[model samples]
Target: MADDSHLRETPLSRTELLRGHFLHVVRDTVRMPDGAQATREFVLHPGAVMVIGLLDDGRVVMERQFRHPMQAVMIEFPAGKLDAGEGSLACAQRELLEETGYSAREWAFAGRLAPTIAYSDEVIDIWFARGLTLGERRLDEGEFLDVFAATPAELQAWCFSGEVIDCKTLIGSMWLQNVQRGEWVLPWAASPGGADAGESGT
Candidate 1:
């Protein structure tokens, strides 16, 4: 099948714009293939990174924090917006430690997700961290959160029962489960989890 033959371009024209704080806003006029036109507003944002930290005992670390936009506290995987010129893996390491006060000797890039593609341009890289140790949590000035660890079953229950409402966290948990069952493998897993599989503080 020559799928390219069916492709049709959507002509666009800029109508408005704004730029600030890692976001670029633009209102674009698009002409559909059917000859109709519409204006779409979009925000371009720098991507982010998230971590699914797993303990040696197979427990997963999560955090509970208040999301101002949703006006509710939610349990989510530790994550942060990518700093300018920062590598995804580095951002993942920094976020995990800052949010949970923990670091891992082993790290693996799991996957990526675009949480809101229709209106926002943001990609979130997911990671799996193991060989854990505790460290000083260098949280941003306005950040506040509480951390907890849960087994696979507990995590699933939390997701299905509405305790964990963050989409990214749920996706990260599912990915970790698949990886643990050997359905997925980390990009870099030389020795995998070994006898020294548990929690530690830095």
Candidate 2:
């Protein structure tokens, strides 16, 4: 097996552009594998957090909200953008409570995903939230959503029925299912006898 410590990583030189309401543009100069050079444009983001909140009975909590860009209501896991200087786990807890009126006793980092790589540098941090307990929901001033819980089969049906259309939610739900089935593990949680690579559900 290849020595994990010897793997090469991408190195880039970047310049920041427009920094506005939760968005920033960055220009990157990267070295090509063929000993060439190239420039890549990326929208630097603060990243995001998603919660796969599993209830005590094994159902997963989900939210239905209208996405302005898609112009449609979609079922999605509770999620929110990371505030500047906020931790991903913290964001997960906040979003879960605010959007679904639920809090979990156990939280684990499931994995990360890049929803859009072609035009943005966004890395979404996914977390698994279990041992859930109901609480008072606190929605944002203009936010509106309907919350529900579903089993794996129900969620799958919703996905195929066009009820759950958000890419991130679909990926997070599948990741949660695989994790529960022992088919996935976080890189940091891997041991000598476990999978050592990071798995991307995207």
Candidate 3:
């Protein structure tokens, strides 16, 4: 692997700008590798998990929720931010059940993604859940969304047609398509006892 220390930036000082329900904003003064100073402002997230749940009949669980920022109902996979001291797998399982009322007997850690790498220190763990069983959904207070199922093909078509534009969902579509084609293999296992994976210190 190539060494990247030469491109690293060291923080000189940091100032908290905003601390909301789940978003923490901060501004920082950093020393560039070239001995120059710069300012960087970004959001600090607790990280999150996005589950691409596969049903036995080849459909995937999906959600349509109104994102305040987008001001539109957006289609996405079952996802949520990690609770305090929560692991990625645990968050995935909780989100899958709470947001969609589905639980999986088998799971595979797909990968991770930083949707806003340039502006936010948020990293979302990608998970694949299969052998699903449906139950009653438990939505959080003040949370409103519609849960449904769509085939991988339908989801991919939306990605191409600019219908499903959520970055995580778009990326999830990529993972689903490749996995369906057998190009990307996932490490499948039975349910885990909740150990964290790929958590970024945001």
Q: Model 3, 154-187: lDDT tens per residue?
A: 9988999999899999999999999999999999
TM-score of each: 0.85, 0.77, 0.93
Among the numbered candidates, top lDDT falls to 3
Cα-based lDDT for every prediction: 0.79, 0.76, 0.88
Q: Per-residue lDDT of 1-202 in model 2, one digit per residue for the tens?
A: 7676433334578888788876788877877666567888878878998888778888889888998878988788889988778777767777777777776666778789999989987899998867667867879888999998889889888778877778898898689778878899743322112121111111
lDDT-best of 1 and 2: 1
Scored by TM-score, the top model is 3
Badly placed stretches (over 4 Å) of model 1 are 1-11, 15-17, 20-23, 189-202
Model 2 vs truth, CA RMSD: 7.9
**How many collisions between residues are there in candidate 3?**
0
For model 1, residues 86-176, the per-residue Cα lDDT tens digits are: 7787677777777888877787888899988889888999988887787667788888999988888898898889888798988887897
Off by over 4 Å in 3: 193-202
What TM-score does model 3 achieve against the real structure? 0.93
